[model samples]
Target: MAIKYIPYFKDAIQGQALLDNFVRTKRILKYADNNEVKERIERGLPLYETEVTEIVGKESDNLVIRGECISACAYLKENNIKVDLVYIDPPFASGADYAKTVYIRRNPRIEETIKKAEEKLEIEDLKTFEEKMYGDIWNKEAYLNWMYENLMAIKSIMSEIASIYVHLDWHICHYVKILMDEIFGEDNFKNEIIWHYSWGSRIETQWNKKHDTLYMYSKSEKFYFNANEVLEERIISEKTKNRLKYKGAMITDRNKGRGDQEKALPTDVWYIATINGMAMEKVDYSTQKPEALLERIIKASSNKNMIVADFFGGSGVTAKVANDLGRKFIHCDIGINSIETTRDRLKETGASFKIMDIKDGVNLYRNPIQTMDKIKSLIPGLKNEDSVSEFWEGAINDSKLGLVPVYVPNLMDSSTKLLDIVLINKVINLAIPELPDEIKKVIIYYIDIIDKKEINDFIKENLGREIEIELRDLKEILSETVVDDVLEYRILNNEIVIDSFVSDRIIRKINEYNEKMKAQFIVKGGKTKFIEISEEGLELIEMVSLDCTSDKGIWHSDEEIKINKLGYTIENGIKTKKFWDGKIKFLKRPLRIKIRNISGDEIIFNVI
Candidate 1:
């Protein structure tokens, strides 16, 4: 096969032009209002509105928004939520899949069996599988377009003295650097800090790619940079110390007239180690950065109590570090896993924050990747059709309409999630024309719509082919009858005893994993042992909290217990070396009980 010579800078001019037009036009797409959002933008109205879903801890300025970065920034700008510092570790456009290791909790019921066998429960004994959080795959042009919009939105919400650090790798950082220059004026460009780490796989074909670039840009000329805050400890040579002693130099003179002689200003090239697996702060998130990395950035660019915002908060390290440094934070991400991880991590710090979700239609599942995986099973009669084009998800065998091709939007790509005039036109002008003649009808699933009537009218007027167009609300389909975990609990005296807990999702995942493993073992001619679950199924529960304060509305974890992967118990944010005993004691009469599964699914039951 011959190699295609596609230049790395292929979309430079086109991407710049697209960003320029976006800056000049100022058109926005608000899918939640069911109207053309550009019209609202022209009327000088907000692009998107955000609604607070849950208020965590006490009322404070800290925020954790579960939505797209662009929408979050737009809402922040509209609400005047400006930030002094911004650090975003976005997808690097590396064609790879990122997943979290889903580990089954230790079964306390099997303690006797484990003890009799003279074996201690280890991570290897636990049944674990990879659950994809998100995919970093992207077309170059599309990625640039998405990044441009996000960068512009971020720049809009930045304060006059604010600085942003865009974290990216070798794959797409150079391209985004150009976009950053265009969005935040080239004169405002500050530093291209190279974060050097030595904890990744080494390649023999070329030099190991171990560093990530952080492109720092300020909103204006006056940006915050306190060198003393991020000063590192300097190591003086023995020769230099001897010379200083012989010359009888003062401590201030030896330290360049500074009182602190040990600390020196950090350079643009930062050498920080990645998070270790066994580290106490490790949250098992794929792209989680170390606290030291964010500590330096947060301290140098932001002051105490100043607002720090991270739009692409992967594992909430930025938020946690910012809170530790006494800076209020706004953490935003589209993934539900990220939101839950950040929320739990922030809870450990006792920081008060409100969890907000943008009124966009993407809140159907845990995240887009899982939604896409379940989309096939959710749709009735939808099956894989190899003959159809890639644009179409699958075809359904209709009773009267014959073969109806179904077009499910790729949830990972935000561009396809909403159905508007432009997307409808693309379907009519590009996708529909390539469909087979026998396909009389097409079912298009959409997360959100601009206007159903407007889209229907556009399809009727522009579509030259005589085909029935059916637009189905994917959110409605996905919202139907979700199976929740079963919990059996009873209040005894002052303690609420959880008799048993069962997660249908966890059980299903276990069965599927065992069957796949069995097949693999059969192919390799090896003995296979299936993972067994206890009848009580108490092991599936990772956390159990009681909200004795209120039974309705916002959740307040009055008393809680979290069982870590290593069987250690964390009671009320304090980790104990002792394992969980499966008993929860409450201070007052419990009004509600919240149980979180090992995979982060939470189900709340009212005390009845």
Candidate 2:
């Protein structure tokens, strides 16, 4: 069976943080109007309504629940977005410290000095690197803990016909294997794919570790398996000489035989070619596996359009490759630089995707529940009311469920008012308006608690049979929605997350897409030796042109030019035009001409 997953951490969390939760937790709770809750209602224990979400196209049911895996798994189990496939890469636990950022000095003499400064780290980025990437989040213990928990949660989501792949190095692979076996059943253990590469770095004291392990596990005997999706050829060269014989004399001639030494089934111990120099892709996100390496894994496991997720999406290399191969993907990283890396890579491909952040929950989309519910409420017959707990709980699950409680700090006699909530079996049922209001100033409410007994008793006392009574605390979960009077838009935690959907504007034309309505940029190349190209050449152009003025410290110099943070390169040999504003400057045929240095390095340009 195909796996389905839903984000349910919000449900499993203790307490109702809303106003409606107080009224309902103290009273009887009813299931909201939705097909998923109809069965629960019949069971006399209706689950909280799943929030209807803002959706564009009718996307597939495949889900990618975004959370630190551990908390995420418990939440998924509480809800129902079960998963089918699991793959991840964890810390090897090798003694080497993995900082949030890395600083590389050109010479070995400065290594100790750099390490000393790094040890006495003040601001995050400076300590990590000369070329700092993402040090802030990379060094957080919280992120590492989240990774382990996700593995735990993933097990519950996996179906009987599901399998998981955990990638690890010598440091943590063994421990992760144990963890996987414990999470997934030990009986369902699959192969340990040893990805062997021929070359890279080696140690003089010992043999260099050139391969990594991919631990595969399945829930049961049957799983989704595609036989021939592997695009990679198993053999580098034909062994015609090895075909000495097939079997007995009658089976085949001496020259033509199905040689046992010839290419056969690709073993779990795959030895693929290593990625040395610029292999097809433009940049190498260090620790990135070769395309051929991932190709074999995909071929052995899935087919096109299968939903794939990578939580530790470092450079987003795996997800990018998966996308190119026509696979749907969900990849995330807590590190800012890593996310930037993913965004840049995806932008290059022009891939359409939603940006999800943990802090804000669903970043985009306005919750249309109130508008839809208000419409239904206006109709006399359609006014089927669920208890306040049920109402708010249901709101939580709706993909379009947007509930930002207005926090009036001094609304009550004391400093503030408390909106207490009662939940039952993770579904909020009762809501009790806290310690009375000093003035009649309106206070927003949310759900907080859902004790199972409280729900049962509330339902029995009110409606006879046991019904769901969910409690919620408004302050605990909900935030104030900033309704922009001028913009007619809502603010999410102070961020002006532009909602393109249902916007009043009729997009007569997409202003951003019009190439003519552009900020003209000036690009030039400095003198060079031969028509050669080094990464330095590209860096110089970018430093001077695209780099921001405030961040000029990041800019460096090359042989031909000195670059600035704004990506404006100063050609050292020949001076450039001072007032290059709006002129029909010609490259003579952009990308065709070779702007070379004395040492044979060349540079290319993409005008836009």
Candidate 3:
């Protein structure tokens, strides 16, 4: 077949005879959904419910898991994050189309025979069919821009005493070298390290040449470089420490001489290609660079705790080596297939990884519900009374308070209601028992009868801003009990968290309260701990109760919940039942109150 054409980076690998046309093995599609495959996610097995977690065994040295190389560079530039050394073996952008099959849901290329219509190519979904191929980039400007944007981001994230290595061939190597000069500064330009690897080639016209260039640059005039870190010096038999000691004494050693140190600090040309695919060190990426290549550059340049960033993280060779060597990494790639492949490659090697798995065309899989489930798991259980007492609460005395699901991205939306709340899936808050279980977000609505006269009186007296019921988030009314007759929120995390097990109405109420009071709750999940959700819409604060006394009971005044000290100082004042005028007094200061629950079996608040 004719070689596929790439306009931009063609020259880089064009003249170069393809070395590893099929050297690399098949890498795991980390993103592909394989029903048979099970991953050991960082989050421990659920006691009962499933939860999402960050990558397992990640290095603290790395910044964000999904960090971009350019993003890492930004941190280096801004001095926000740190980078001591950087290495990138960008795609040669080989225009020639390499061959491979395609799969979805981890299925083999069942549709390989079918031709993928050209129109399907433009669409975002990458399920089209055609023989897999590799090609160089067409637009040189676009490629440069793409490389430049990331380089700038990387520049920002590097340190002053850092170094960078750009590995390439003849094609765009010089062009990229120029770009590097612009990015790192010509003054700090180090050496163009030449790597010489020889494979048998018989060229009828000209002498066969074999080597790749590694351009090293630094941030400042000074950077870290350890001589010991360079490849171990080649030693002759006599040069061996033991042999040298007895060299003159033994005839065998006497003739042996010290191996000449290929002096002059490994000049422009380095003649060595450590290992190719046939070697056991082989990995899954088609462009899986040898670890020795990266180790040489990394060891020669930076020390421990330094950061590394790579943009074209094909197969994540740089990240894997850097991670194993005790350095942090910011790895990025635009290909969707490569994201998962890179992630798994780094992971299986036991090198900690903060992976940025990016893929194109396929839908962006948003996995953020972990945070909600964590919060839900911490809820306190409700205590049910004996059969006789349960009757009083379940039937006679307790009133039905409804609960519902709510989906509110923003509380400022006009479609929300005072009573309607969205129901978040149990997996997010309360764990749900279902496969492919998604958080069931819905708006809640409930209506209940109360003391009409007292309600009206209180509404009139307080001069409370009457909520525009119709204007607020209102939903269709429903009458039923899927779980119970009434809904209530049990205490959890020292706050009134949504008792998803309680009333669906309460869920809606919490959601409505979030809308009305602008309470913050977790939205995006993907957490394993108590991380704060700022856009949570409403603040989940601890409540402060007061020991104020009233004619009928102890009273506390509070418009919002507060975490208060003992004896309930009015940090957040205690609230009580309002009677005479119906106008509720929003107390700002401590008020004198009395207790009425003589039995102390319950706590009561009566506002005077």
Candidate 4:
């Protein structure tokens, strides 16, 4: 009997263009909404508005983008760039929150604050902390849907003769396999590779899951796979040599009857060591894969200069190995840390690429409190935090007057509004009149700018009582304030220069975190000292690496250099920790540099 996989809720996948495209494309058939589906497929998927931030190498060599994977794929498709090979190592849905341990330098300015505390302070106190990287906790349904959308986007940009390797663990591999089968067709399913390692925890009652599944599938039967490129050499034993001559004449004797060796192409099982603490390739990322593993997949499925992509580009091992193997790549990840780490890794290899970010202002809209606070700053006499309410038409503290709300649509589309006529009528006729006469003043805040005459007509037509209305325009306030600082760089002679370092930003952010920490301490009634950095904050730089040329195999000059806050250099196989002069200089032309701070925060930039 033939075997088949059925995902948890396969029937629920309807009207989603991504899932439909897989079946529609393979069978040359149409779904129910064929027109919309065809139009979407033809026009390519739409992505968040993105702007290119930096370009390190040549414009065509590689791309490192910071955005969600599905959006990144849409961006790729819109540009007419198709990839021949894709290897994604998405979150394994282990329900564990992964974090990175960062060591922050004990600021000298905090020494006095520590001593003034009620608790005795020690000079040897540790300042290291943990920060959550990404959340892998997801219910099965949400995970499947998220993966389905991304996989669909990925599939749309794949060349007809391409291969995709989806890396997953035992937790959700079975479900994902069924998803792939539904999307890519069962006949095209190729291998279920087992990548075994030996290091994690072992349960007393259950067998240790030391292996991960890598699902390899081709877009079509004509997909490329070069076996010779990834073949492993095996030594011929005497027994095998004797068996080789079983016909008494030897089968054409390519080895001159010696049977000395044979090339053993890799099977579905791959045994590669996980990155250890001391491994040269280790970059301290929690989910970093081994370079050897990526190398084999890249070589076997792709050729030099062909486009290779990894959407869940955690640790950037896929791109690093692809660059080393002489392939153009497009790496995408949503995390700022992932983007920074990948940029640095690519720069260390001297690979030229562009960094882009989604330009849509959705993040601003999502934070209502911060958005409201910013709006409050622009309006006079609205400084009282007690008077502000996040919801519309809410009573103020001990006051009969309540706050009213209005909104313009998104900046991109101003015709929309949060409070339509019906909702406005409810607030004016129902909520406003019920308030006591003492609440004569109604503070009206507009989330965005709109025509004032329309607002006046609405207020005049609806209100029955004499109420003083104050209006504040959030759009005007946002326009006057700077949104974000865009970073750029250039290489002059043997030196790299940038617009500005992140030192001040780092200090400001640390201060903000410290303020929150202080709030927690106050609630707990515990003694804690506030952290602060000194004027010479550049002393926080822990390490810097540079790739002067577009060669992945060699770094221009990884010479031993010293940095403050405990920096180390490796020479020959020994590691020496020292504080040396922190002067970094590199040859110009296609330069990439990665600068890391003591707190493990890093930035990767390219100088054109």
Candidate 5:
């Protein structure tokens, strides 16, 4: 097949060589059922039902969907949520793991005082932990596929007169331009806006590349654009200023009136400063775009009260600017930190918005409801309906696995051992009693790679029972892995109690590395070491904020709580144990709690 357009690299694979690679990976469709999405959106049915969590305002009826952009876009399509404008600042394919620095304050103190004191603290003054926010590492083919699927999904939900602005650097903008052309049609192609900013890193080998490209595309030929609203006045011409007086009026250009000058629209090239470290709008997140940049896009493409959206909501500048410009916005992102940062930023704007999770990060493949059936098929002589029913009962109530415990039956044979048995059978629909007498050794296995200790404990608790049980992990068997990372907490008498937490995913990684390498990692040393992870997971947990009574996504009064193995308090030049084991007290009820992890992933849930 003849290639249409491909960005050639020096000494890189070219033509069919590159096309072959692209063709190898099957295209990923939007995660949402397109027909279902369309039906729901057109019918005005609620696409999301998870009690719209308002991150920071007095009940925003507006939406903030979290997950993959394709999922959010699919949901938007289902709800017929027509977006007047879409701005995406997706990964530029920059080969770097952009991380956000998280700080833990020393000395246990009151939440109110901590928030106030934190405002005055600098990045260097506080003890810090670095957590990866998002990874921008992608090969050409993977990056193209990722962008293509999202663009197609975004196109389905756009209004007839909607416009899209894709903010990207030089790295992948050209390729994405081709992708957008195929999606939006070449005729609808608009300007390749140059957002020039200073303070970019200077390199010796090449001239400073200090500008980002924003490719604007419309859904149709005639789209909404307000040039007059986004215009920049031209500076007075030297010729007009240096003109000699003729009679009553100066011998200058007759079109030099103040109002006329103001009518001059800004060019496609815009000069906006990058968000500095000390900027009030800066949320300490890397790759954060400036408000001025989004302000121009929001004002030019969308009108007041119109719906705007940003799928790749890095730092939430688009949502904040759109909300401030009197436009409703829908912000979607895969990163937990992105959601948390944007939610907090929008809270300051006091924009009422609902937070929805399309994909459960905590329950990915680990969902007990979905995985239990598949697990039953893997075990030998345990395909009975009663066994499957029993598994579900234990899983729903289990403290550690949170999965239906496998049902292991005692063997009838003398030499049959439970530990030596392999769970490798497909379903034959035969009853458990119909199985051969030699296969009576039924061993229930929990395939976990990280929760060895937790698995061992479960085994010990069930030992000396009629049925034999064995703990199996990913290392031992090829069965599916489940991560039961949950926070066990309770609220009674207006006080919050954190009983325990299971961060199995992080612990598993630590254990895996510890066995492979001789060097001892801090996390491998046990639970005493602070649990922190890259991207979004349990380790990202930093602080939990509880608002006593909040239905809207706003936190009125919050008790900031942190978990530490050892914490101290200082009073009158004497340090005392304020918290025995990161013990926190909350004098509130019907609480709305937002738990922010190290990587900025937050879960805002209520305990009423």
Candidate 6:
């Protein structure tokens, strides 16, 4: 069934009208209370705040935040944290689910098996599974609304001289371009850069989609752009060289007597190669942009020591590039994978940054996708009903109210997380009216509320229908029990030896994968091969570190080893291309050990 809720910006709100509505009402859509917003507007207070979780390295101006982009922008704006440049490679709305290839690391405990089968093990022979990082699926109207709010939030925190490079692909770039113009002003439009790359699947039916669009816009008329900083080496032809030699001083004053190996300004069409497999810069992140691409953008738009911010910091390419360029950076993303990847990457670079989480009350799981997947089983009696619309998650059978349709917020969409007047009005005016006549009650689950009393009173006043409205706190049913990974370790002669490691999540995922494979094979009338794990289960461990220094607050990686997808170990910030020896030799007595699973879930153990 069709969703009955009317979008805020319906067909009537087009172009200037849409812009005018945002401007006149000052209603930049956000997941906050109307009263709080009004008070902030009246008192000139920041609309949002940030909570620092951990400080990595010496305290500096760099920040790596774990939260949604909208909330991150709100925090930055509230703190008056303006940046000179912003490069965001957000989801391209490709209707595709992107995942990271999770590889089972080589078991160091089984040295005899490894030595015998070393030559036989190809890259495909290694056990690997795909873990979904995030989904880029979106409804057109919802995508536009989300992008509009994000653009507005980002625009508010940008410095007058700041430049923003929005990296998107063919999926929804055109739509977002319109929103960008409305939020940042059409006059501030700079250039539409086409980043051409040569690594994607080829199709016989159509031309290969091997490039992405980067829309560059400035916050104001006078913005920074340094062509000299990002100049490309000119490819001179012999004919052109001879002509230039003959012309000598006759050429234009700028090019007069220029050498053959001259530097020229790069064009809007950048021909940078995509990061291929086996590339050192490849961090195995699905949406990771090439460092070369970010380098050019950062150099052209910003200077050294200036702050560069990336709200959609996938794999922290922008942060790393900015750090290498001697510029401070602010990296923000909602996924735990992104934050961990970025944190480890920046740590390798020895960059000092404070990690922060936006106080948005959505940190129930590693990310929204996982949370959405797990939310189904959490609520009792919440089952899929054929009668209800897709907008409603499912229906609950209540003894008193019969079949009550339930509306749960799409955690992936930040706008839906907070239950405010706008959302309540939508439910009352549109959604509840479309429910089946027999349905007596409607349950609305919320992540956060603006004000419970105000919302309930509004619902009572505006909900003219005789339906019982029940507002349920999603967080109430989201209580999680931490399952600690089993580890067997001991200090032997100043060396930490881990004999066995078992991750409950990894084992469960493996069983699930095997079961699915077996079912598929059964359908095909064939036998299925299951992935066998050694009793030691050392392959499940992705990285192992020993903190010989501190036992309390911040974790210091004194000695560490990270196993890449190809089964090579990166030891102590250096890629050895060698297998892990299953032991960490420490100079001091080890106090703690941290082991991360193949899926990025880490657990720590205190040494006795």
TM-scores for all candidates: the values are: 0.88, 0.43, 0.42, 0.60, 0.58, 0.87
Scored against the true structure, residue 560 in model 4 reaches a CA lDDT of: 20
Q: Candidate 4: minimum summed lDDT over ten consecutive residues — where? A: 1-10
Candidate 2: regions farther than 4 A off? 1-67, 71-83, 98-148, 231-263, 282-284, 360-608
Task: At residue 93, give the lDDT of candidate 6.
Answer: 79
Give the TM-score comparing model 3 with the true structure, all chains together: 0.42
TM-score of 6: 0.87
Model 5, 207-251: lDDT tens digits are: 999889999999997799988676554434564443322112222
lDDT per residue for candidate 6 within 1-608, as digits (tens), equals 00112222112323331344345434543322333222222222123446675566787889999887766765665556888999988877788988878887777777785684456567777777777778899876567666766665676678889999999999889867866877678888899998777788789999989889999999988899998786655446755542211101112124536666565555677777888977889888988888888888988899889999999898999999999999999999998889889988987788888888766655455667877877788888899998888879999898987999999999888767767777888788778778888888998999877778999999888987788889988877765534679999877897888889888867887898999998989899887777789998888888888887888766777788887765677777677757777787888887888888888887788898
Clashes of 2: 106
- As a whole number from 0 to 100, the lDDT of residue 36 in candidate 1 is 26
Off by over 4 Å in 5: 1-59, 109-122, 236-263, 360-542, 547-588, 591-594, 601-608
Clashing pairs in 1: none
1-608: candidate 4 lDDT, tens digit per residue: 00111121213334443345465453432223333332333333445567776566566558888766656776676667899999999988889877765555433234543344324444345354455676676666546655765676787788989999999998989878877886778899999998877877789988977889999999999999998886655546654543222112122233454446565445676667788877988877889998988988999999998999999897899998998999988898766667767876776676877788754333331122233334444444343433433324233343344443322232211112222344355457665666556566665545422346676789888778888666655555555653332234455676544333345434654777788889989898998766655554444555556655544432333322324233334221234552223344554444556666654445555544
lDDT of each: 0.77, 0.37, 0.38, 0.61, 0.55, 0.76
| Candidate 1 CA-lDDT value | 0.77
Residue range 441-555, candidate 2, lDDT tens digits: 2123322222435544654555322222233343332233222111111233412221111111111112222222233221224332221122222211111111111222221
Q: Which of candidates 4 and 6 reaches a greater lDDT?
A: 6
lDDT of 6: 0.76
Clash pairs, model 4 backbone: 57-352
Provide the lDDT at 381 for model 6: 89
Regions of candidate 4 where Cα sits further than 4 Å from its true position: 1-44, 105-127, 235-261, 362-532, 542-608
